[model samples]
Target: MTQTEAAPVTAAPVDAETYAQIVQFYSHHMQLLDNAEAEEWADGFTEDGVFAQNVKPEPTRGRDTIAASMRRGVDRLKGRDVVRRHWLSMVVADRVDADSVRTKYYAVVFETPAGGKASVYLSTTGEDTLVREDGRWRIRHRLINHDGA
Candidate 1:
């Protein structure tokens, strides 16, 4: 007898309203990060959310910790006249439940220094688990996998 592996299960298609809400969520998230609104960006997550990167072994958990980390990064760039933008594309979302969604998207981080042309600083893929809390979609867990990693 031979053993065979089963195929992965795909999520069901979401309704128009759910799809629109997800798109808006991503847009607002990107906007907050690009504008260096660390606190606001962190607020997009649940109280006990987790943010992990492929390059790092440990994940950042909780809103306070997440906000602090973002603030530190912002402080490090305080003296530099650099503009950072997060461009997200190829977004695919799966509904986990009526109030939860799982999504994956491609991300490109572009940086423009002073008057210089914009260049790609990082390219990565992100997997996020979002849940509706208090009538808003908030990220419960996010994993960022860097390109070529």
Candidate 2:
């Protein structure tokens, strides 16, 4: 295959380069959230992306709304001098189509107050539908469920 041609994304497993790219994508994506860059983090999603959690009555739809929701939480934490971090691990990707991937992973969230020790805030699992937009991976839909709930 030529360098420009993508290796097929299959049920067995993606090639090393493809897997590395997925890991790199999540690393940068989560770091943005950890750093409280809400708008930029939300930009990792498609324009009509959806985020749904088990605790919420309804899913947050649209990239703009997702950013707004994140902003509210970040602002509230900042008021109390607290910082939140998200860690995603155990990622497994399945090719949904030529252009889309479904990733499932474990997530742990930590919160730290100014001069205080960090504590686990939440433990969950996330399944996301990812698509390439403009040659970048963007979330099209995300579903997160609390570990014990």
Cα TM-score per model: 0.91, 0.88
Tell me which residue pairs clash in candidate 2: none
Tens-digit per-residue lDDT, 44-69, candidate 1: 99999999999998999999999999
TM-score of 2: 0.88
Q: Which number leads on TM-score? A: 1
* Model 2 per-residue lDDT tens digits across residues 114-134: 999999999999988889889
Task: Tell me the lDDT of model 1 at 105.
Answer: 86
TM-score, predicted candidate 1 vs. hidden true structure = 0.91
- Model 1 superposed RMSD (Cα): 3.6
Name the runs in model 2 displaced over 4 angstroms.
1-12
Give the residue spans of candidate 1 off by over 4 A: 1-9
